[model samples]
Target: MSEAVTHSVPSASTSPGLLASLDPLLREWLPRQRWFAGKGRPVTGFSLVSATEVLPLNSGLGLLHLLVRAHQPLVPTQSAPAYPADCYQLLLGVRETLPPRLAPALIGHPTQGPLAGLTVYEALHDPRPADVLLEALRERAHLGELRFERDMAQEIRSDLVPRLVTAEQSNSSLVYGDTFILKLLRRIVPGINPDLELPLALARAGCARVPAPAGWILADLPADSLGPGQGDPGDPYVLGVLQPFLQGASDGWDLALREMAKGEDFSGAARALGRATAEVHTALARALPEVTMGRAQMEVLAEGMTERLTAAVQTVPSLLPYAPGLRSAFDALADLAGEGQTWTAQRIHGDLHLGQCLRSPSGSWSLIDFEGEPSKPLAERRLPQPTARDVAGMLRSFDYAAHSLRAEGTQVSAVSGWADACRAAYCSGYAEAGGRDPRTDPVLLRAYETDKAIYEVVYEARHRPDWLPVPMAAVRRLALPEPS
Candidate 1:
């Protein structure tokens, strides 16, 4: 759909040494790459260790996968969530190996000729890698073989191969043509992912905001140190899962932003979004835990976000601003968290935001991206917390949409009006479904919004510093009472 063509590097390594010829490729590729979030910065190291053929030997031309491993460990020195050391594991996809006559010009490519010098092939033209990976997944396990525990359901499609669709730091998404979006977990941890879980539960409860699962992928990872009370013999980590890839969906984050950028009234849509939120939470309450607004859980969340902020800052020094006040803010907020007028605990969208939601073709909204913060460990993500956490996430997303588009050269006109409409629509919708009153909880909402804004400001600073102004704007807008 996007006019941007995909340029893939070889999957396996090309040679033991770092290929000097690839220096130009690496430099040019990194900045334009969607997967590598650290684009603006220079790469510290780029090397081609060796090559491995994933498919059968004579699989086809351009299938020579050179696992190009590059590392650039630079911490941000900013006043927000510090950046962390992130590794770029590129699966280079070359289309065709050139003739011996043109080998000199294309040798640096190993398989295909240079983009500008000679004729070449783009591996995406064939789409075999996505195919091989899917075949490996399906026959690897049967429908009823293993307990489908990761909160996802599965169904096989006989039509197409899995294509790599999305790339974030911790996960890579593979979409098999139209059938499914298989999220391959990177930097995995022991046990199931919460994103995979909450959606499945919502689906089971007949909630409509989620993209229902067809099935999922799990792995029996090595667990040398078994926890004292953990179950399962060898199923240590959840590798990934499969969900219906919305073939024609607009990013809710974008929709919200475009509205804000145009300054259109989004209050109606905002109410609808709110209604959907309440419905999902209600469904979650019915499906997961007995709603208990308790202190123990709040404390756990406080500790977790605090540590995440610290880690994010250490990795990217650009986010150093919020670090100094993170702990004290958490400590102060933790008290207000459990002592709310009335707290209701339920299974929540670990990572809820506009990006996590999709606008269906019919103008209906559906949430995706179940994985909470991609950086958080799996075990911590599975913990239950306030639904307000999810609420804060979506609100922050509204801010993100507005800011991201302003960066896209879109004119800023009635942007704030659209944002207001979205809020109205979402809130009205959410309140109707949850039996809550938006008018009655201004202070409570303000506090949660502030809490979330601080986190968002730090998060944006780390990932999209250009977009940091979105959350910063939110921080300026919120009416948080100073600690007495």
Candidate 2:
């Protein structure tokens, strides 16, 4: 079973198209994937963008590099507009038979065509092919438009073995002997990927709160906005990014839980984390362009929040009682905008929460996953947003941690007091770190928190039904009448 399969390379001279044979397999497998965004909908069709063989087709093994477009129609609902087609990268390993070690990586068996009677599996799951991919990047190899480039200043050891990080969902990560990690993005959109763009900018600005890019993979595709009527055309889309792995780092969420279990005060750590966050924001603002939103634009932002709240109540009926209160928060924001208020906006972590951060053993915090809200368009994710949004997200995370303890029958008063102290210290640290105090602007912060809670309600209800109470409680708090 370990023997390599020998088959004619599918090229221009081949009879059946290589992509045509794999079409059915992809359509069947894509929707079943957890990383696939179109979970509730069926995949209607596919459009092959590119099919480049990383190695020669008839080499020791068959490795096909493919970028395919999956078409999924909107679910039958008036509020539901058609979701745009998404492009995904597939590194397919075709073998005559899979070894026991690779048995878990099986995609499916192709019954006919060029891949007839062969086992095709996701290559990243197999160390052999995964090493081959890393070698290609290390050697700066080029196959057609796909290029692998690395920072020459940073050393890349080819000897480091590749092992897949199994817990990832939206993307795949492989650690090379604990020295470096490569994050291969699954769903892709053309243009600059913020996951790569933001970190590079911050790293150059001397920001120590983010992992610097050691290497990356990119593909040049036809230029197009991926709109309804626009044809296929776009610039290079970042396929993956590599960075030095943080050794002995713990997930922020896990750290918080540990502290709660020990009954230890976490205000000190929370304050330091807040300072780190502000420093990164400062670096980003210095590196990127900053903008100011006028009253008109603020109103537009309020409308967007209202729309989200409206949709959320339809699914999470528990939100019905708090809808009016949440709507008032958005209204207050709009009223301020009408009074000729303006706010500064800049590049931020976009989606900031405890789970998205990592705390190292050295007592320092690093922010990861710069990719903004997954449901948003790529263009919107790149837009400058109010920094208050990030602050609000962290504040909500504090509440989530406390409520999780309460759900476990912990004393509500004790956990609530602890959360309140941490939240206040975090805000104080942000102000001391040369950032604006979130408390100074209650309207914007409250609105952002409401918007975030509304989103959480829908997400928790769908994914973790038991956790729905955590966000539902926030909705009620945010909806409460202000102190007169």
The digit string of per-residue lDDT tens for model 2 on 405-451 reads 88777664446577788889889888878557888999999999999
Superposed by TM-score, candidate 1 places the C-alpha of residue 175 at a distance from the truth, in angstroms, of: 3.3
lDDT of each: 0.57, 0.83
Worst 10 residues of 2 by lDDT: 1-10
Which residue runs does candidate 1 get wrong by more than 4 Å? 1-54, 57-126, 136-155, 161-170, 225-233, 261-263, 291-342, 403-413, 438-444, 460-466, 479-484
- Among these predictions, the greatest TM-score belongs to 2
TM-score computed on alpha carbons, candidate 1: 0.67
Across residues 1-484, which tens digit of lDDT does each residue of candidate 1 receive?
1121222334333334324545666666555555455555667765442344444223344343333435555544433112233323343444335445434323234223232332322233235656644654554532211123322135565577655454354567777877678775543344667767787788788887887766565534234212223434564445467777887888766676666655666676677778777777788889987656446766765676567667666665645654555455566556766675346666777777777777777878787777777555456567666676677667666666765666666887766445545555666678788887553555445446656776666667656777777666665455334445
